[model samples]
Target: MSAKTKNKHDQSESPRLGASAFSARSKRVTVNMGDGQKVKTLTPKQRGATTEQKSVAKDVKKVMAKCKEEHDMRLDLSRCEVTELPRYIKELSHLEEMYLYGNRLTTLPPEISSLLNLKILALSENMLSSLPDEAESLLCLKVLDLRHNRLKEVPFVVYQLRSLQTLFLRFNRVTSLTPEIKNLTQLTTLSMRENKFKELPEEIGYLRCLSVLDVAHNHLEHLPHSIGNCNQLVTLDVQHNELVDLPETIGCLTCLKRLGIRYNRIREIPAELEKCSDLEEFNIEQNKLKTLPEGLLKRFKNCSSLQLARNQFEEFPSGPPAQFGPLTSFSIEHNKVTIVPFGVFSEAKKLTKVHLKDNLISSLPLDFGSWVQITELNLASNQISKLPDDIKHLTKLEVLILSNNVIKLLPKSIGGLCNLIHLDLEGNRLESLPAEIGYLTSLTKLSVQSNRLTVLPRGIGHLVNLKHFSAGENNLTQLPEEMGTLESLEELYLNDNPNLQMLPFELALCRKLALMSIEGCPLGRLPPQVVDGGPSAIIMYLRTQGPYRAMSFS
Candidate 1:
């Protein structure tokens, strides 16, 4: 009873059908039973009906012939303009789940292999190009979607369906895969994403109980070193392929875990993935990796989220395994890391989110406390002007991005970071802000967007959980009328503070203010009492202003 009280009682017991009452209700109202008495009416059209409508049509044909003699038969002709299918549907013969998806069906009816207790067969978005070698006699088919069909070639009797296990042929004009699909061997999730597959059927390593293999946006360059013999593969999404190199027998699968080779032209990293020791989330973002195979982080010593951001790393890579155990989220953002090496993140120690944003670091190792379980520190576009006052020992910091740094000042020990929550210091040259940053108090998103702030720290109304306050491109000419006591501010961007003119009739006592940008502020207008106490205010009010602009919510 508590999941936010069952999602507010299922959003107050859901029932919201309005697109013109669901496009004029195409059948969905029913209730009628009798002889003992129970009835409600809507459907009534059995021409020449009498004698209690012929005994209610013989009790609905004896309950649909006892539900087609138990189970089976479940047909849904999607978007029904139904082109074909009624050869009395092969006399039902215990049909089982057949949905001809978004149809204009080009063909299909070798009497649909006489149903044979079919088990899920959806000819996806059809205009089907083939598939009726009696579809290999169903044999209790088990899931075959045939995605976006205009199929060039897929039915090698669908790998002789020995009880198929999920095979969705994505956007098909299928270019390959029928070496009799190495006889399916009980496939376990094989989606040929955006197909026209240019390679991939070295008998796809004979299935061997495959586990989720998505050939992402294909035209794959190379990949069938018998796909490293499938060893129960676990999620291998080949991103935007044209992969230049990979089949170092993909380090023999060793139960691979989430490996997305992003936008490849691969420049390195295949030291045969150091035998994928249970790899855990590794996305080689936009590849062309320059230098990183010095035993590739000591062979991902149980990696835990490593996205070598943007690539061609100029530094920061000394084979992560001086006992580097279970790393925790590390992104070497935009690279060419100028200098951050001094015990380079001292054995990671369960590091917590560190993305040295657009680096060229001028200074930081005043013992950056080997990242004391850091919490989201992105040193945004660096050339650091000053920070290491032992950075007040991070103390599980919560998002401190330091946007475009050249910091003019700040370290009032950053209000001893009482779990700071998002503080961006946007495009800095900060003129002010450390009156101990109004004592942090779990600050909630505060960005001094493009700074040179002329004023603001009148104890920022003691940050009672501030809620999004961005001094847009500053040179602020006014604002601390205790910022209308913030009362849970909800967005107040203060655009281009060109000597901000009005705005502090105690900010109309804040009443959860909802957005007020004050565009190019020298405010020749806008204080009809902060526009009538922000009736969900969104005033950008600009009347003729020049120069002095700034608004970067980065």
Candidate 2:
């Protein structure tokens, strides 16, 4: 009747899938990952020089001469301490681009305007508090980057750049922009993040070509209604502001796709957002909204991901509207959701992840297990009591976390989860697990700590892939010696099993064992030296009982 002896006997009679068959099924659950695509930035040009290019900071004269020799060339003097531009730079007026970023220059010399061929000018990260009026003479300039400077206001002369397409003014002291900023009709990207702009000029709406606008971390309390005039705007970021409400006109941006307004004082989502049909990702976490406006979810039907964490929601909305069918990921953690409507997730076929952790839900819907496509299901730290038997429908599940709950038993069908890799049942009232647990051959981490279990199924030995096992603070009088079959085991914890009487000699055979805890167990079989010794010594002493005698660490 010994567990290990019984396990070996069962292995002969039991019907199990062969490696070749299991490999085919595993492929059905596992997806072939593709190479990640490189992010495409909206910067006008790539910064930094090629590895073979020498630094041209020490001698602008020689570098400028090279630019003159070539009708069109680039001159980079960025990251150098050059305080002034030599008047000779005016001779290389044909230079197509100029870079003077990260320097000690306080002003742009009037002579810099002589570069009529300059198209890209990067003068960021300097001590510039003012720009020279002559800078306006470069009519061919298309990109202007003056970010990370001490300028309290954008130089009025910059408004004269009728050909500029991109402008950056982030991390500056610019508090006001002249009305003439609207004259940059060709601008496509404008950044003013981390600035002192208390208010944006209405003229910003005149940039019809503007597609991206970032103004996060500012003191603005309101946006002008005219901002809605940017009909081509695609991405808008205005997080960490004092705005109590968004201009109703914001819904005018029919092309907007992504909008982030987290950490704001907004109390409600504007009804006008119904016009934003293309809005894909909407982040409005950490706001003061208590009740979601009705029909709001029906507005952004195309949003793939939505986050409403850390809000004052007492109960989740009742039904899963058809509009939410396309969602891939959803989160409502750290809320007061007492009940999650069964219909809320019934339609989410493509939903890959759902996080409702740290909620007040006491029980799941009887059909909760119907969600089979989910790869990661985190319902930890809830008041759930029992899992429904149908949970086996999630055959593709990889991570199942039910820790810190009142779950008393796992469904016998849990073994059907052939792809499960991690299972956590800690801090539960479970008295026992289904022997079917042995069927989870893919399991790598299993934790049943702080439970009321008196014993584990002998079939646990079937988990040949297990690497870590935690079973502390249980009522077990004996551990199944079959656990020694975990050849891949690395860390094991069996502390606080007060009634345990002996050690499993077979455990010493686990060569991959590195950490083991067996404290609080009264075992007279082990010598005082072996008992006082740590995992290595205990393992070494046990191995001596066999034919292999070896020294080990404390």
Candidate 3:
């Protein structure tokens, strides 16, 4: 065939999406080859991914071929676009592990049962809907992964594998677990996330060896009380479900350490949960919970993190006027919290992050900086009108967000935070900044847009590490000449300063500037060509022009 015709025929045989499933996993790098056609190449990382994929895919065929000459055999054929098992795999009677992930195979060949010694089988991410009866004959199999498949029911044959210890069936369409599951008493870990199940069989309690159970993102309306029989369970993740209440028996699992029940319709935290003395991480956020029982809060005081955002807790609920030991991160954003009582976290010395965005808080306590270990404090979209001067005490603060508030001034000590990296004070009524702001040498991004500022601190020049400066929609008519020393500034947003009439010539010294939004500024005397040239032209003018001439664009 001619070259054009040959290319056309080859394209017809290739998958419309890509060459194979292996190619789908690699990052694509397209290059212009001219004549409307482009060629794609793989990045170094993706090239390595292809090689690794092929190596694993070929292991299955190579091992089975050499099983007769070798004592031990194993195979992995994932991501090879396989639709069926190799006819010769039965020869590897000693195969211990078989991996066939990310393929088109819909059936587990009955012939595979011949490998009586198989200990693990991974058939995740495929089109398998049912298993053959022969699957039960593999009595020695200890681990099975059928995640992200088309299975619509629990494989009854899987229950026959009494030795199975770890079972993963996440992201399947299975609706419910049957009593047959109780037969697999050796299960230690079970994952069934993103499934259609509305209930788990009470027989699940029979798995006394179960240590972890993750059924998150399912339709489970309630958990069986028998689940408490799993005395060995340590971590239980059932978030994003319709569970309205706990089984009360949850407290019976005294060994549970991490319990995640967020994004549910639960109205109250069962008092029985206090019995789980081993709990460390409790994520009950985004639920319909309006009241936080004192018992639950007291028990969770030892929790390391609590995400209680987007809940119905009005009036700060009734929990803590006490310390939460080990509590490093606490978020209660988008609630009806109007006040953050003083010394709320006085005992929580390890606190690092606290997010209270979209609340009704109006003022901060003078000792707010007492949380010395705090690194991030987000109080955006609140009603605060002023800030306490002691805000400077938060020396370790790295991120401070106070946007959309009615504040008129910043504590002069605000610049003392040497570790501050990102500071946002947009939409406030600030008139000026303290010159002490220059003390923040670690600042990388600063936002002061929609404020009443007429001048910036001359000390702003000391921020040599700043990368972004948003000062748009302000009342500034002139900027400090020191702005030209910002060697690291890449974006300058000064779009709506309408009263500005002069453009500083020193701006051309900003070698790293890639974007400048200066449209709404009324620069009456500056050369029109300079403004029209965008950021690059402005730099070129500064490079060639000896001095910033009032009337010259050259």
Candidate 4:
């Protein structure tokens, strides 16, 4: 399947109850940055405009005149490349919102504090290393965006903003937060990703209204136990940190919904997390976990996606099927699991995606077919040798990747997957494909490379939508003349099939055939020039010499 189509399918099936869904700052941002709220930047009138005083003065003059004439409450001077604000900016005291992002300002004029009614001030992407003392006078200010700056610490004036609700300091040089941060009791969203913080002050728990707190991509070794005091938190992302484990107080966050702790050095999950009943998305992919805490899965009744790839898990976590009641996507790839216990996933009737690739799985349980709603199933690089006939029940399966497996035979029931678009059977021991494969009319990409097949089923010609077909490194000789019916064929791989000695003349019917590989094959009847000239030249030779009328390439 094409990546666009696959992504569309994935998006439609996954639930959207994560942090981005709950944070107001994230929704208001014009440019999205992963799972965290970002600076709301605007496009400049001219790309890469310089910080010329004349241009800045002209733009500021026009904006000031408009505010004076219409009593406008919003002033937009963003991306103007201004180095300093005019001292007369104090005259715009009625302004309620101000945008000055993407500028060269290293300091703000004391006159900026004159906007006593200002609610939002965007200063992201600036050269400022600190805020002016007068900034504390903006008593009505609520949102302050200072991302992408050179600040080495949270400005002292920031702690004085009693009305502030959201604070963005991403991509800064800040190494620590003052205990005074507890002064912002109204702060709901605090995004400090990509910073140099080694630890957070325990005073963060003072914000009872805090909802979205993202501290990802930092050097923090542990989370302050005070984090549990913020009961209103919906999204807490601490991924890419050096934390060894979570504080037991985490269980007190009953309102928590999405917890992202991937790419960390955590060795075990604190059982306290089971108390967060609202949890839906739990990502712990690259941790050092060896086992799931007892009854942890059973308590997360709302979990829709669980990712534990690259962990030290040795077997499927032991639990009742009820733990998977709401699961739609699950991945445990790169583990040492040898088998999937029966009925483990039987209760997950809504399961649509599963990834168990690169494991030691030898055989899928017979109940695998129960996941009739599954769309994408990847079991590549495993030791499986055969598939159950019950696979026919997965009529909605689209992408099936079983590459590098020891499978020798495919059940004829596979043809029932009428929705399958990409089938990767590369590096398998298959001797032949079933004729029922012709029933897969939706297939666009098929791979049977490095197999022991001597001849393709005549059904190969029925795949009118097939674009990429790989049958190289096989035991094949001549291809079926029916291949001429593949009107959409674009690339064909027939390299390393030493038994192939002749070309099928009917192949000239595929007008769209642009790339064909017959390397490592001994076709003694054809001249070396014709073989070296590629598909276009070979097609021309077959048309003129064999029984077809000559046609001009033009």
Per-residue lDDT of 473 in model 1: 79
lDDT of 3: 0.81
For each of the candidates, the C-alpha root-mean-square deviation to the true structure, in angstroms, is 16.5, 15.8, 8.8, 9.1
In candidate 2, where is summed lDDT lowest over 10 consecutive residues? 20-29
Q: Which candidate has the highest TM-score of all?
A: 4
Evaluate residue 336 in candidate 1 and report its C-alpha lDDT on the 0 to 100 scale: 75
Model 2, range 1-554, lDDT digits (tens) per residue?
Answer: 36586345323322221221000000112223456755443321143332212233335556566667865467776655556777778887878777776666788778988988888888777888988889888899888887778989888998998898878787788887889998899988787877888888888889989998888888888888988999899988898877788898998999999998888888877878768888898778777766666666657778888787777778874344565677888888777889987667777778887888889889888777788898888898989998888888999899999999999989899999999999999999999988999999999999999999999999899999999999988988877888778989999999998887777877876778899888887766678777878667778877787444453313
Off by over 4 Å in 4: 1-53, 517-524, 539-554
Higher-TM-score candidate of 2 and 4: 4
Ranking by lDDT: 4, 3, 2, 1
Q: Give the TM-score ranking, best first.
A: 4, 3, 2, 1
Pairs that collide, model 3: none
Query: TM-scores, in order shown?
Result: 0.37, 0.80, 0.86, 0.87
* Cα-based lDDT for every prediction: 0.73, 0.79, 0.81, 0.85
Instruction: Show where candidate 3 strays beyond 4 Å.
Output: 1-63, 317-322, 546-554
Please list the residue runs of candidate 2 whose C-alpha ends up more than 4 Å from where it truly belongs after superposition: 1-60, 78-85, 100-107, 124-129, 149-153, 173-180, 318-320, 472-479, 493-505, 514-554
The sequence of per-residue lDDT tens digits that candidate 3 reaches over residues 1-554 is 36586346323322122222232243455556778766767663455546544654575456456655675555666677666787676777888877777777889788888889988888877899999898887989987888768999988898889999888887789998889899999999888877899999999999999998989889989999999999899989999999999998898899988999999999888888888877888788889887776657666546888788988877554555553656888888988888887778887788899999988999987668787889999999999998787877889999999999999888888877889999999999999988988889899999999999988988998899999999999989888888888889999998899887765677766778888888788776667887677657656766567364453333
Give the distance in Å from residue 552's predicted Cα in candidate 3 to where it truly belongs: 20
lDDT of each residue in 1-554, candidate 4, tens digit only: 36586346323322221221011111121456567777556444332443444455776777787776788887766666667888888888998877777677899999988999999888877899999999999999998888778899999999999999988888799999999999999999888878898999999999889998889889988999999999999999899888888999999999999998999999988889889989999889998998988789889888999898989888988788888879999999988889988888888888889999999999998788888989999999999999999999999999999999999999999999999999999999999999988888899999999999999999989999999999999989889999988989989999899988788887877778888888887766688888878656777888778765565434
> 261, model 2: CA deviation in Å?
1.6
For this target, which candidate reaches the highest lDDT against the unseen true structure?
Answer: 4
Candidate 1 worst ten-residue window by lDDT: 16-25
TM-score (C-alpha, index-matched) for candidate 3: 0.86
